[model samples]
Target: MATTSPSERLLKTICGSCLILAPAVLLVGGLLHPEETTNAARQFEIIVANLGRWELAHWLIAASMLLMIGAVVGLAHLLHEHRPTEGIIGGATTMVGVMALFAIASAEAAIVPQIGRSGDAQLFASIVTSGGFWVLLGPVLLLPLGLIIMSYGMYRSRVAQTWVAGTVALGSAAFAVSLPTGSPVAFAIGLVLMFVGLARVGWSVLAETDEQWHHPPQMGAQLAG
Candidate 1:
């Protein structure tokens, strides 16, 4: 049996915790998010009305993104022996997507409040319509794309159950759709499904024995033969 080093144990614990918590934080943020309308002026009004909640929610979302990045890395580490290519590519892509989301959340949490308080809906609308904004937002699509890729890899590797991987992919699609349409209900549902899938993964991670958790990738491959 492979001995578990302290560092390995610590990393494993952190990964499991992140998988369990990230989705919960995102779900809370989504639920707290105010509904939006097509009218920039009305959107501004809603923001101003729920300024504190809005800021808090976006901040939570940003935090969740950071945690998600860590979770992705952990998952990639686990998948390395089984599907190295997918693990590396999917983890990198997901990290990029999560970083883009963090940027958007930061703007909404820190910058949007100021804009809302100024009551200048025109400015907000203009910013939203700008090329720069779209450029920054474009990478958000990678989140769902990377998730699908990673989930498919997990399925192929038999690391994750079919239903679990499917749920993650489905949730990613729904969440991606919600982003463009600004649908809070859809966001909430997506988060719930994501939570279910990730929580199962987290549980599996936690259930690993010390020897299994610390097994070297090369050793894992040899044992599989």
Candidate 2:
């Protein structure tokens, strides 16, 4: 096994840590989100009353999403090295899906929560029913889709063990299936599977110098020059 270069090691570490942390942050945010009551106004009031915590959760969620984007991009680079063609497809899918999810979350973080804080029942009611709410659900499935695709790519590329690949693909699919039903626990668990799968591949790359990553001129300059 070839020892991983310093630059490669840094990216793997980032990928391992961030992908692992992303789901945790998401679960915590879900737990922090206000539960709906029978009264619409009452719900808004509750969120407003706990506005500080609500905003904090959104901020954390936003941060986690940003971290995910970084991790995914890093992982893509690794995958491209493992299997140039298929790895690109897998990594690209994951990157796009995760990016979409992140974009939606970031948008909500910027505006949707502010509506709750404003204490406007009419505005809240109107906004919540608007396309904005549905848009949130739109990106939810993309994440799992990407994960499943990436897992398949990993398996095909011989990037990880069969069991690890199966776990990632199954878990990701389950996560997608569970989302519409509003299951945060399942999503979090699915993320754990992906983290483990990525870890297996990442560690292999880190420990084995069999795979070498060639950075472009600009990137090489940034990392080594």
Candidate 3:
């Protein structure tokens, strides 16, 4: 087995955390979906009404936040270790991606319970249509942009698969454009992209590290002697 470095371990840990949190938050969002009406105000009401559940979601989001912080710190270490521009850029891009997610999650956490309790989908939709949900747009819409940039950095550094990075870029773009059309298929595709990209990055890290362990060079071995 290849010996692992502290820095790599740290990166893996952070990335693993991110991997775990992404799905967890998504799962929570799904659980709350039935409660979320089209109405933004009602969403707020639901959040308020279901304080305990909402609070639990909020606490669960800490995992995501911790992952982001760890990624940022790990990126710094990667930069220091290699002085590579790609590392710096990738790290910063990841920071932005996580930050956007955190913001989105935070906003949703606030308003979900409210709307959930309002029990009026039409009213919620009206509020969202009236720009009440505009705040949600930034985090939802802009996240893919950050992800694309991060993917680009990963592609350039060869830290991740090229196809995965490309998918993230394309998927983000699709989601951004599809928001206005409200196309479920397109939106689903976009979600798939983001989730797949994240998963790929995490899996790649583990695979790369494992490969290193199993393929270490032989000591005092002659080169084609």
> lDDT of all the models against the reference?
0.80, 0.62, 0.54
State model 2's lDDT: 0.62
* Reference-based TM-score, model 2: 0.72
Candidate 1 lDDT over 1-225, as tens digits, reads: 777878888888889788888888888888888887767677888998999999999999999998897679767866787888888899888888999999999989999999988888889888766666568757987887788778877777777677878888888888888877877777777889988888777777776777656642322222231
Badly placed stretches (over 4 Å) of model 2 are 1-9, 36-46, 199-225
Using lDDT as the yardstick, the better of models 1 and 2 is: 1
Q: Over the stretch 18-87, how does candidate 3's per-residue lDDT look in tens digits?
A: 6535634543543433244455555556655776676566545534555545544433332333335645
Task: Give the TM-scores of the predictions, in the order they appear.
Answer: 0.90, 0.72, 0.58
What candidate 3 gets wrong by more than 4 Å, as runs, is: 1-10, 20-94, 115-132, 178-181, 210-225
Clashes of each: 0, 2, 26
For model 1, give the RMSD to the true fold.
Answer: 3.8
| Candidate 2 lDDT over residue span 157-218, tens digit each | 55556676688788778678666665666756765665565545444444433244342111
Model 1 CA deviation exceeding 4 Å by range: 215-225
